[model samples]
Target chain A: MLFRIIKRTDLTGTQAVMFRTAAVFLALLTSSVFIIILGNNPFEVYASMLEGSFGSVYGIKETIIKTIPLVITSLGIAVAFKMKFWNIGAEGQIFMGAFAASYFALNHADIPRPALLVIMAAAGFLVGGLWALIPAIFKAQFGTNETLFTLMMNYIALKWVTYLQYGPWKDPGANGFPKIANFHDNAILPKVFGVHIGWIIAIVLIVIMYVFIHHTKRGFEISVIGESENTARYAGMNVKKIIITSILISGGICGLTGMIQASAVNNTLAVEVTGGVGYMAIITTWLAQLSAPVILLVSFLFAVLVQGGAYIQTAFQIPQSVASIIQGMILFFVLGSEFFIQYKLILNKSILKKEAKGGI
Target chain B: MDFALLFAYAVHAGTPLLFATLGEMVTEKSGNLNLGVEGMMLMGAVMGFQVGIATSNPLLAVVGAAAAGALGGLIFAFLTVTLRANQVVSGLALTIFGTGFAGFFGQKLTGKIVPGPITTFFGEAKVPLLSDIPFVGKILFAQNLFVYFGYVAAIALGVYLFHTRKGLNLRAVGENPAAADASGINISLYKYTHILLGGALCGLGGAYLSLVYVPTWKENITAGRGWIAVALVIFTTWSPYRAIIGSYLFGCLDIIGFRIQDLKIKVSPYIIDMLPYIVTIVVLVFISMRKSKENAPPKGLGNPYFREDR
Candidate 1:
């Protein structure tokens, strides 16, 4: 049968939500094929995944820890993406931020606890913002392709951290093992009820970002620039300044994630500080459609997938990559479902009749 | 350090990159910025290695790799071309999927060796007269069949992209799809064909790594070479011929750290590892500063086209 695709201009909110939900269901159903191939029952494997992620208090805590970075970094990415700036260097920014925070933590352990924590946060924010600023300046001044430029920066940042881990920052007490020294008590972030203060910080930022993006004048300028740089300029916006400012905020927030992860989770900075969270945040940020509230929901769901994926690796003797495979499938199905939301396919009756008559 | 051997090894190391850059260049020339080269290469590497082990045939392995890569390309094309999804996000999703797919299957193949016959089949053979030349001969003429194919592919792609009528039509589509559509060019056909062709070449590049470079299966065997290839496409300004130089230069950068260590130079290996990425950023800045129109990306690049929207 012949088919024609037509754009749908009248999609309702409920319909869009239904499409996404169906896409997610389809992703799980398809990934079950792989689970079956691995000689496991699909339902049991999926049940194990759910049990693993939310089954126990520890499992729940680990999921939240993963969610913390995902949420913070996604929020940061949303800012630059709102201006169509494609800042793909969150990985690099996170590393630089962790490095900067670690430097002060290691050298000045004598500072008071609250004061040291504040300084580390400031250091991460500044260093991460500056690391991102290099590309922003090049982009504004020369119109360089930010996508590839930011990507290159990720490696550079990674190598820098690697250098520090094996060279200067190598703990002298570890008997030649290449690892950074653990943070002093003053350098660590205190826990709230059960988790690190990062969760509290995450919620606060969500509120601030919601207000900044939808209610503020600068945020309105950002949307205008995203729509069309020419239109923003016509409306007397300083386009270059806005781009630089938004990226600084974006990169700074990512840097804060690095500091939190290092001080709270790892208790020491290393090359694995970001652990692919930087790249994954891009996905969550996009899936969230650049909305603060939606980012929280999406990141939480993604964390469940990650935590469950990790759990299945041991429980079922399955490889850790099954989780990655499932995540990829979900992304693909969700991405494809967007097309259905925006357009509809119709059967072409005339073409079908012609084909039935065997006419060329 | 032996300079001659370094150059030879640089050319050997660069062969896979040349293939990937050429593939991505073709895809981008059709106005689709697929950022899934790393994932596609991994898929090719794993599939090629598996087929090589199964059939003990080098040719079949390569074909398998290319087919696997094309499958990856097909997924990307369906999303970005037919579904009109955001190109950047869709490409990232493809990369994630490809990485997982390769990792899952490749886990069993770890430490397995390629069959003896396939290894011998890919072994180096020197060109008689060409191998006799002092510096250039050793670097270019004396290499395995896979490396030789890289040279041919580079020249062939250059001719196809710049000199052929079909190539011109493809470029027109990338530069201005609405105009190309108005002129009766099949924009979707050109995009799908080029994108698939691009994916196949990327697969070959991945196969080169597993079947030729290392001759074994390893998770993430591409080791960000796919990403380096993506950067090289921009570094070479979408020209296949320039890709040869860019790939080898990066290849030299890749091995220079090892060469330095052999010479007892005190430089940190990590610092040396950072050179290629740093150079790409610097070169990108310089290229953008020049503001050369010819060096810019396609006008319609990264935007989904709908004849009705126009």
Candidate 2:
């Protein structure tokens, strides 16, 4: 059969949604092969996954905890992505933020609860912002590649934290086990509805980001820059300044996630505090298409996958990486499906007729 | 620390980076910027180790690793080249998928030793006449099969990229796909071939990590070497010959921290561990500052080409 790929100029909203849903279903079906390979029933595994994530109050709360960092970091990534800036260094920014917050939490345990928490948040914002600023400056001044620059920064930030954990910041009383001192009670974030206040913070940020992106002049400027830097320049926008400012805000929010995770989740700074959430957020943010409300929904679903994946590890003797495998497959299917949405394959009648006539 | 020993170990360490950088360089030359080298490497490492364990053949393990890596490249090519999806996101997806795929299957192979025959086959051996030479021979010629392959690959790629007509055509496609297409060069064919070939090389690099470096199966055996290889491509300005030097320098940086600790230096190893990444950033900044056209990336890089749009 002769077929030609044609671009679809008028895809509807419902069609796009349908395509995405099908992609998710296809991803699950594809991943079922692996479950079958591991000698388990795909349906049973999936049922347990759903049950583990939302079956009980504790499971739901843990899922929420997982969602918090992802939502906030995705929001931060969405802002930079809106400007076409590839800030893949959220992992580093998160680490720097956690490190900054830990500094205050460990050193100023005597400070009152509310003030200390406020101070830690501010410090995380500042440190994370500054850490990200280095690359933005280089990118603006020299037109350097931001992707590699930011990626390199992740390792630097990680190694710096590792240094502290084993060297200057090591808790001497812990019998030489390499670890930083835990945060004091005053530094920890309080709980609301069985989840840390980070959930409330996440919701507030979502509303603020939605308004900021859709309503504000700065947001419009960002979109313009994203579409075309030349267009933004022609419109009298200070491209360099806007890039720096947006990245600062972006990195600062990611840093705040570090503070929340450190204070509320880990109750202290640790190397695994981010738990690959920074990289995971990049995926979620892209999947969310840079929308704040959509980011919330996407991150929640991903958190369920993660929580359920964890649950299956214990319940079915499956490897923890099965979750990652499923996530990756889902991303692949969804990413591939975007093509089908934008274009379609149609049988070429003329070519088919020509071939038929030649055959005759 | 013995200088000769240090240099020798550096070459051994840099073999994987050399292979990966060369592969990525070729792929980029085809106008595709795939950021999933780390993921591809993991896939290669795990698969190569598994093959070695199952078959007990070093040659088959190497081939298997390259094939696995090419499979990853095939996926990226399909998404970016065929589907015309955003290259960056697709590459990231490839990375996530490859890493997860490797980890999922590699769970059983963890801690398992590479088969005796396979290890022995890949073990270091001295070239007869070359080993008789002085310090340089010991440092360069006395190495495993992977190191030798890296040398040959770098030299061959350098020649092919500069001295061959096909290489010129590839460069033309990267520089201006429309012009290349106008000249009757099959853009997709060139991209698919180079990308797959590049992936194969990346796989060999990963296999080197498992079959030679540690000689055991382990999850994430490549660590960040794949990323380092990506950076090295920039540091070399996409030159295969320059990749040799860049990879060795990075390899030295990778182990210098431990070397300093051996010298009883007060400097923390963690701080030293930061050097390669820091050096990469500094080199990138310098490269950008130069503003040399020769050092610039391919013009059509990271963009999906559609003939209809043109």
Please report the candidate that would top lDDT against the real structure: 1
What would you estimate as the lDDT of candidate 2?
0.90
DockQ of predicted model 2: 0.71
Residues A54-81, model 2: lDDT tens digits: 9989899999999999999999999999
Off by over 4 Å in 2: none
Q: Model 2 Cα displacement at B53 (Å)? A: 1.4
Clashes of each: 0, 0
For model 1, which pairs clash?
Answer: none
TM-score (all chains, Cα) for each model: 0.97, 0.97
